[model samples]
Target: MAKVSISLDAELVVEVMVLAGIGSPQDAIEAVVRDYVVRGHRTEARTELKDRNLREVDAKPQEPQG
Candidate 1:
């Protein structure tokens, strides 16, 4: 797996460590990244569904000619 470097505030780091009981800052950061990725995927899926629904509505057939 690839590695990433991110900067965090001192207070935030302490809070994460206290809340999660994680041994290292990296573990807490990884957890946050995983959650972010999962939420992003969900948002993308919702956006795609909305777009598809709009297209279906636009493609609906009109009334038959007299």
Candidate 2:
């Protein structure tokens, strides 16, 4: 783990703490950063699928009775 020193607005920190349901400022910041990274990954994946003209298929197995 890397330790970083950052300056943030007190109000913003409070808001992030509330939204993330975390009391530690570090946890709140890490949560926000992780969410941001995941969102970027999802966006990239969607764009790649769109470029390939690919759509997700729903393939449900049907039960056959004699």
Candidate 3:
């Protein structure tokens, strides 16, 4: 993995460390970012499937079963 150096507020980093229960600021930030990305991917997957299913069902003609 490539490492990049960026500046962030000390107070914000401390908050993230506390919330994530991670002693290292870098680890805490990385964990939080990874979690956010995972959640976004999961949400996109679920919604994309749901939308496609709805459109497919609506486009098809349903016959009444006797």
Tens-digit per-residue lDDT, 1-66, candidate 3 = 889999999999999999999999999999999999999999999999999999999999999889
Alpha carbon lDDT of each predicted model: 0.87, 0.88, 0.98
Which candidate should be chosen as best, given lDDT against the real structure?
3
Across 7-36, the per-residue lDDT of candidate 2 in tens digits comes to: 999999999999889999989999999999
Model 2's C-alpha root-mean-square deviation from the true structure amounts to: 9.3
Ranking by lDDT: 3, 2, 1
TM-score, cand. 2 vs. native: 0.72
- Candidate 3: list runs displaced more than 4 Å: 62-66
Evaluate model 3: give its lDDT. Answer: 0.98
Per model, state how many residue pairs clash. Answer: 0, 0, 0
- The TM-score values for the models, in the order shown, are 0.73, 0.72, 0.85
Q: Which ten residues in a row have the lowest lDDT in candidate 2?
A: 53-62
lDDT of 2: 0.88
What are the root-mean-square deviations of the candidates from the true structure over C-alphas? 2.7, 9.3, 3.4
- Count of clashes in candidate 3: 0
For residues 1-66, what per-residue lDDT tens digits would candidate 1 score against the true structure? 887777889889978877878869888867877889999999999999999999999899988899
